[model samples]
Target: MNEQTVTRDERAGEEAADPNRLLPDEDPSSHDPDDARHWLEVYDELLDFKRKMLTIAEEALDGMRDKPARREVVDTDRRVLRAECDRFEKRLAFWRNRLAAARDGKGP
Candidate 1:
């Protein structure tokens, strides 16, 4: 989204409702629309993966009550995914702040 351009605020409860943007991002690529597009694609991929992980974890935990090893594996993998989600959320805030600053004439 460009600072000079108008951003939709009517349904702007979330970035998805704003037509001017896709998933928030950082890096020099933030200036390119494709960067945001690619970020969203990757985000969707990760989202789907996370859902699958949950289903797999549930299925694994439901089976083999005597097996405690699956819990360890599932917990570890879930933590990794959680860390990635946290990272992405922070990155999103970074990008959003950048946009706000730019719009306010406080950013390069």
Candidate 2:
């Protein structure tokens, strides 16, 4: 099971008032190799985007003395980049844990 499945199961359990169904089985390490590859690829893309955003933020800050409006735009982009970074960090951690589990012969 993936994150969505687990979330759905939790919601279903809450709606049904079933404590036993609250925790969903993930078994992440059992996912196919292709699926794992896809997850990694997405994580990499997020990281790349985060880097690009950071670069933009840096460039904007560097030009702050020359263009106040550019700084504002850069700040906004930085905030968005930070948010995306946080989101992607969570995803990366999840996949890393799954990978570790797989290596250890345990399902994530």
Candidate 3:
């Protein structure tokens, strides 16, 4: 499956598994303070995970470059990791904005 398809499938599974999954347009004010805090914590964890993945991918790419036989594998892995990082970055941005709006009393 393509990256977009995989991302959608993953999101669907996550939402199914955790009904509290946050969406981009979620109104943070609708949730209690504790719930909003929990969501922020989750976002932090996911962001950290993506950062670590990006680091590992970069390291692997660097190491694999020395082994000509693994060029394709390295490239594929890098692409996947980068895509995951990008996805997480976008999610984090959305959550941050939502949190800010809620804090500013501009959220619904």
lDDT of 1 by residue, 4-71 (tens): 34445423434432323434343544544455445545655665676677567667766747556766
Please provide, for model 2 over 14-103, each residue's C-alpha lDDT reduced to its tens digit, 9 standing for 90 to 100: 543332221133334454545555676777796787878778777767757768677666665576566666656666677776666666
lDDT values, one for every candidate: 0.54, 0.62, 0.63
Q: Against the hidden reference, what TM-scores do the models get? A: 0.47, 0.58, 0.57
**Model 3 Cα lDDT, one tens digit per residue, 1-108:** 899999998886555344345556556455344455666677678768867876876666666655864676565555555555565566566666766777787755
Show model 1 residue runs off by greater than 4 Å. 1-29, 88-108
Model 1 worst lDDT run, 10 consecutive residues? 10-19
lDDT of 3 at 28: 49
Each candidate structure's count of clashing pairs: 0, 0, 0
